[model samples]
Target: MSAPLSRPSYAAVLRVPRARSTFAAALVGRLAYGVVSLSLLLATVRATGSYAVAGTVMALFGASTVLLLPLRASLVDRYGPRRALAPMAVLYAALLSVLAAVTWRPGTPAVVLGAVTALTGACAPPLGPTMRMVWGELVHDRRLLQRAYSLDGVAEELLYVSGPVFVGVLIRFASPSAGLLLSAALIAAGTCAFVASPVVGGLRGSSGRRQQGKSPARQRGLLQPVLVAAGAGLTLSAVDLLVTAFAERHGYGGDTVAWMLAALSAGSAVGGLLNGAIDWRTPARVRLPWQAAGLGLTVCAAGLAPGPWTLTAALACAGAFVAPALTTAYLIADETAAPGARTRAGAWINTAVNAGSSCGAVTAGLLLSHASLGVCFAAAGGAALVSAAGAVVGARGTAVAAVEAEPVPEAALEAESGRSGA
Candidate 1:
């Protein structure tokens, strides 16, 4: 077993052999994920001259991307990222390029465009899950993995922030189609480079082999992490619309909305870094509910702010909980994955967060129609409380023992990696 360090620096994570190159390539490919939605949404809206048409196309696209992620992830676990990711990235890029050309001028048929968008979304490579899986391989020491994931979560938040800014720049100078084409180029080039890395290149497929009888990922332990993740997603997604509504209600300008959202992102980034810097003795399963509840409470508190600046402050506090909750959940998911199921395990968390976000939009819309802003905030926070309570119940109610009660040794994790490869 690897000895636990007092505290592993985030710099130490990057120092792991081959980690920097693999991580950089993965980020380049994943940035395309961050960029595509806004780029495509704007392009579709411009092409159809109708928000309704664009909305439908985007809905289809998002649904395909989130719902089929597990299937895509399973392929990565089975065949390894080198083989699985490159082909998906190429096909996905090809579709996006087609979309850019089709949406260049107005009056494209909605159904035709929707078909292409859905196909494009379906082909999205599970880069985030695959990258996390690679992190598991690169760092066997638990402390280093914790630092690595925290660093990853923080970087991902920054990527989403930067992706929108990149799209905005394109819109300022060129067309939205330029962002789409840029997304295409990034994914194709980045994925090719990612696969060529020595770490990824060494992996092999043993999909049919039963090296492990049944993965713990298939057991009951995944429920808590997945549920908490979904709850976190729900509250976070609701904030976007809720803040906009608050701004409109107060007669604040659109920039107020942007500032509050940015505040929230800033908070998350700081929180993620802080979370990574610590070396906690508590198990992740023990810590998850507290983190979930913190997010819930802070968000509810944001609803009580009397002015825009106060609201920004409250949202920033809420944001602080976001990254820690997600990083903890991913840690649990990684621990649970076992053998040839790493990618799919991470994908489950991804799916829950996204599906919850989709639901959250509709939820906020309904609340805004019938309830006061305070009520909407309370209800969103209340959802997290329920999920936090449910995770505890779910863990105890199931027959399987709590997998997180004890740490799995590094040697066993190594065996898991060997089983996943040839």
Candidate 2:
């Protein structure tokens, strides 16, 4: 007989039948998102010769994407991913190709760039939210879901970091437009593989639609997690700008800024994995606020660091809370969603993060001019603390208590999960 498995590990997540292939395909496509934003910005600047134009185009793209997220996710819920996600990916890729060709040479018309970019953002497939929903479908056990989210979040963090580096390398030998073209290709291929996965094939049928029609599927508990998620995004972004200013004030080089950011990412990755490894009896709802508050406290302390090294250490410590917090939010999202509505639930969390990031960048900038660096950091932390407080207050007033995301019972698991086994 084969030796019995002893401990739960991230490896167990991959062992779920069809989950490995589905998740791998999703990641391949998601890497394109990491590459596209920077590549587009650089390509636009090169062609238009104006940072203002490039920045505006990027902002429009972000806003359009965030605004339409829930609607797109709703389409996926109403239709299966194969029906909904495929056309979206195809159109998005085609528009990206148009973007690449237009910006390949200098002097592309600004009007043309803006038009294509807005359309591209609108068509961008809701791959990340879809993937998280897939994880929910694949892993019925609560522990496995935690590991899956943690793993997914950590991998995503790395993808964004590496995406920029990849663009930098590509620009050295080729034009930034080449990176956009590559992103187009990556998304097309990855999305095709993802939709075609056997597990995804199980997500079809009208059961989801019927389930969503029921009153129990209302998803009343979403606000607390969403609020916390927004807070996390806001303060985390402020840390980026804060670190840049912190590095400059200390006479540190640009490399120090990079190192500090990288440290934050590393800490998040480690923390996420560690968080998943534990078997917690506590509900995600209970843990989430404390996680946000812990992050708030650490960021506030980061402001008090006396030296560059200490500040980096402080940021790293704060980042340790990052992935775990986001992971918990997604868990709550999955729990709160109805059978067919997981995509919409996850998309709301994504939207919250982006909205918070937009405000955070501007808020940090404004605070920098009027306040000391320490004050700026404190303000960032305070945002998170307020979010935590709001969650607590909202819970008290609401008729519905935010329920814990408990493991699905075996009978229900078999009915709900996709091509199960790990």
Give the per-residue lDDT of model 1 (tens digit) for 70-143. 99998988888898998999999999999999998998899999999999999999988888888888888887
lDDT of 1: 0.87
Q: What are the lDDT figures for the candidates, one per model?
A: 0.87, 0.87
Each model's number of backbone clashes? 0, 0
Give per-model TM-scores: 0.92, 0.91
> What is candidate 2's lDDT per residue for 272-386, written digit by digit as tens?
9899988989988788888889889999999999988898899889999989989999998888777778888899999998899889999999999999999999999998899
User: Highest TM-score: which candidate?
Assistant: 1
Candidate 2, residue 398: how far the Cα is off, in Å: 5.4
Q: By TM-score, how accurate is candidate 1?
A: 0.92
